[model samples]
Target chain A: MLRYLAKKLITLVALLFFVSITVFAVLFVLPGDPAQIILGINATPEALAALRADLGLDKSFWGQYREWVGNLLAGRSHHSIHYKMPVFDLIVDSLAVTGPMALMAMGFAVLISLPLGIYAARNQNRHGDVTVMFFTQLGLATPEFWFGILLILLLSVQLGWFSAGGFPGWAADPIGAFKALLLPAFALGVIRAAILTRLTRSSMLEVLREDYVRTARAKGLRERSVIYVHALRNALIPVLTIMGLQLGQLLAGAIIIENVYFLPGLGRLVFNAIGQRDLPVVRDIVLFMAAAVVVVNFVIDVAYAYVDPRIKIN
Target chain B: MNTPLLGIEELSVGFDTPEGKARAVDRVSFALERGETLGVVGESGCGKSVTALSILGLVPSPPGVIESGAIRFENSDLIGSPPEALRRIRGRDIAMIFQEPMTSLNPVLPIGRQVAEPLMVHRGLNRKEALDQAAQWLERVKIPDARRRMGDYPHHLSGGMRQRVMIAMAMVCRPKLLIADEPTTALDVTIQAQILALMVGLKQEMGMSLLLITHNLGVVAQMAARVVVMYAGQVVEEAVVSELFGRPFHPYTRGLLRSMPDPAGRPDGGSRRLSEIPGIVPAITEAIVGCKFAGRCPHAFGRCREQAPGLFDIAGGQRARCWLSRFPERRRTDA
Candidate 1:
């Protein structure tokens, strides 16, 4: 197992290197001048040159990439031309918001999907199955942003249950911060719950047919134990894989929902950075998202060994 | 005589398909007395396995259902009993093992936990106590280093060893009735003999009624005292193992005996072909008005096709579902 973790760690580092390179190169390849975008074209050549040197754009591509990577590895960050703050601090602050929100969304997704999926699988071809499938279909079809808006309309606009948008600082009020994220988190969770529910149901259906399930029943295990303990444990393997992917997706794709709810998150930071051509923030956030995905997948692969003893990692 | 430990009266198990409802076990009835091994033998698709599953109420539903029957275990009717009641009996009063040892065990679970589960579920033994007893049961089944192997998953064990684990799991609770459905069919020839011997030994040790289902007549001869020969979802004949093998009454039973391959060569030192019963068993979907095996019987005559034969009591505690058993003189006349 240690050997397997070491191997996965190597792969993760190699993968992140490529992601960093691509994030760095893609921005450079795009039609934009960070210096010009920051300073108007009317600025004097001296001013432009000063800003270019300050931002390190005056350096060669290789030199700039090396310096950027060196700074990242050292836990130091370049100044954001747009926000005028250290990119690392900005990202950490955004993370403080997006991290909890994304995790809560994920928790919501798993909570909703597991029970609904198991129910659908148990009552397959019955009214309960059909009803669960119908709701999941609707959830899958509806966009998260639209769902977020709908939640605002119902809870905020009409029912007076929650504020329309905007997040209070976590330090001032933790409960308020939680309530601020609830609607957006639920909106994001609904769509993923739909996908996960479908996956869980299909996976459960297949596991239910396994010979061991029959053996469990023959052992006089309660139907609940047979389905939940014996069958669901095996069914969760594929679901875990999808869940890891979805978590990464939630981190990267929360830009629209974050904007919709005005929750100062990583997604909003990246969006504003892209508009202002803040190279360091954009590059780092994209790399962070990629690294998150790669790392999550690595964790999932290790978890498979824990869940199934037959999978011996050499 | 006291009531049999297990009795199935007119059990009919069927499956619904796109084609129609196909009967797998058609009005199959049998009794298993205490400490007796009753072998239900038949060809593939002959419903022997279905009958075994029905005993524990483990038959897969939707596709499969008990069309009609009463499975009397002890004093209660298992058929139509509440699932909770059946569950209480399962793995406690009765237990079952299946054909594929490789697939019948949960791949994710440790074998010791799998074996110990019934005890925890039925006997309310805690994990440590159950594991201790399970280790002993594993040793009884001759698994090497039983306690050490408890942490190993099903894939770590060889097929024969897996079968041993399955036997350990089923026998752990010391059930009153044990149903083994083709338990050793997938093993090596040598492994098959060992498994059979282990099962017979364990049955004697536990003093439990054994319902052994298999298509192998040789296995039936070795493990069973009384045997029921099934053909096309119905019991064609049943008798003491010796009586069935020595003076089989039904033509189907005779065909089954003749089909057993002779290990010794022909006296002339030439290769000899093993005799096989002609024609395949009829598909259950096809409605048969007369005897289900009549089409495959070499002695099939006018009345055999026109009317079904009932399981008739023959002399010496044997039962034959053949008209000839009623009147031996009719054997001379062809249709």
Candidate 2:
């Protein structure tokens, strides 16, 4: 198991290395020059050259990559071209928003999916099953941003329960911050819950038919115990895999939902950075999202071995 | 007469398929007296397993439904009992072991927990008390290092060990009746013998009645006192093990014994071919006019094809469902 952990850790580092290189390379190949974008279109050729030199853009790709990676490792962040702030600080701030929102969205997704999925599976091909399937289908069909807008309309505009969009930082007011993220988190959760619910249902339906399930029933276990404890535990194995990937997707892909709520998350930071050609912030945030995905998957792999003892890490 | 430990009367179970309702078990009636081992013998798809499942009321729903029956246990009909009542009876009054030991156990759960569950569910034992008893049961089943092995999952054990675990789980509650559905079918010959001996020993030790379901006649000869032979979801014959083996009444029973490979080989050192009952058992979905086994019976005659014969009493407390069993002169008449 220790060997497995070590192997997984090594794989994570290697993956992050590859993601960093890819993120840096994409920016390198892109048309916009960060120096030109910062200095403006009317800037003299000399000004552009001086800014390029200062930004170390004149260096070879390998040289620049090594410097960028070394600075990141050494905790010396590059300055954001648009914001004129350290790239690391900007990312940290954005993470402060996205991290909690994503985590809350995931919590909602899991809380919603597990029970509904098990319920649908237990009543598979029945009325309850059909009802769950119908709603999940509708949930899957509706986009997250559109759902976010609807929640804002219902809860914010009509109900007067919350502000329409935007974040009240946690330090400023914890309750307000929680209330602010609830709608967006729920919007993200509803769509994700849809996918996860379907997965949970199908996975549970398959496990419920296994011979051990019959054994569980024969043991005189309550139907609740049989379905929830025996069947759900086995079903969660596949659900965990999807959940890991979906979490990664949620962290990186909540860009539109973040925009709909006007919340300044990592996705939003990356979005604005791309438009203004803030290469430093964009590069680091993209790497952060990629790393988040890789790390979540690594955790899930470890969790998978724990969930199914049949899967020996060795 | 004293009440049997478990009595199943006119039990018919059917499964709904895209094709139609496939009758898996048709009006099968049998009884296991207290401390008695009753064997239900048949080829695959002959309803032996279905009969076993029907006893526990564990038959899968949607696909499976009990058409009609009364499973009387301790004077109460389990078939008519509510779900809660049946559940209380299950793993308390009656427990079941399935054929696939490898798949029958919950893979994720520790064997110790699986064995201890019935104690928690029915016996109302606390976790610590249950675990203590579960470890004892594991040791009873002869698991090595029982206390240490408590934390081990199902996959850690070999086929024989897993089956032992299954036995431990089923018998942990000390159920009055243990329904073993081809318990050793998926084991090696040596393992099969070991499991059978273990089961017989445990049944004797607990003074529990056993319902052993198997296609292996030899197993029935070794383990069961009374045996019921089924073909195509119906009982072809039933008799005490000695009478059934010594003077088999039904042609199907006689054919089953004939099919056994002679362990000593041919006397002249010539390799004699073992006999086999030809033709597969009829599918339950097929509506038949007469005896279900007539198509495969060597002595099948016009009456056999025209009219279905019910189980008929014969000498030595045996019952056979064949016209020839009723009239010894029928074979000569056919000749």
- TM-score of model number 1: 0.96
**Residue-level error in angstroms, candidate 2, position A164:** 0.6
**Residue B308, model 1: Cα distance from true site in angstroms:** 2.0
Q: Which regions of candidate 2 fall more than 4 Å away from where they truly are?
A: B266-271, B332-335
Over all chains combined, what TM-score does candidate 2 have?
A: 0.97
Clashing pairs in 2: none
As for candidate 1, its clashing pairs are none
List chain A TM-scores, every candidate, in order.
Answer: 0.96, 0.96
TM-score of chain A of 2: 0.96
State chain A's TM-score for model 1.
0.96
Q: With candidate 1 superimposed using the best TM-score fit, by how many Å does residue B179's alpha carbon deviate from the native?
A: 0.6
Summarize candidate 1's per-residue lDDT along A77-124 as a digit string, tens digits: 778888888888998889888988888999999999999999999999
Tens-place lDDT per residue, model 2, A1-314, is 78977887788789889989999899999898888888889999999999999999999999999999999999898899888899888888888888889899999999999999999998999999999999999999998888899999999999999999888898999999999889999998889999999999999999999999999999999998899888888999999999999888877748899899999888889999999888888888888888788888878888888889898786
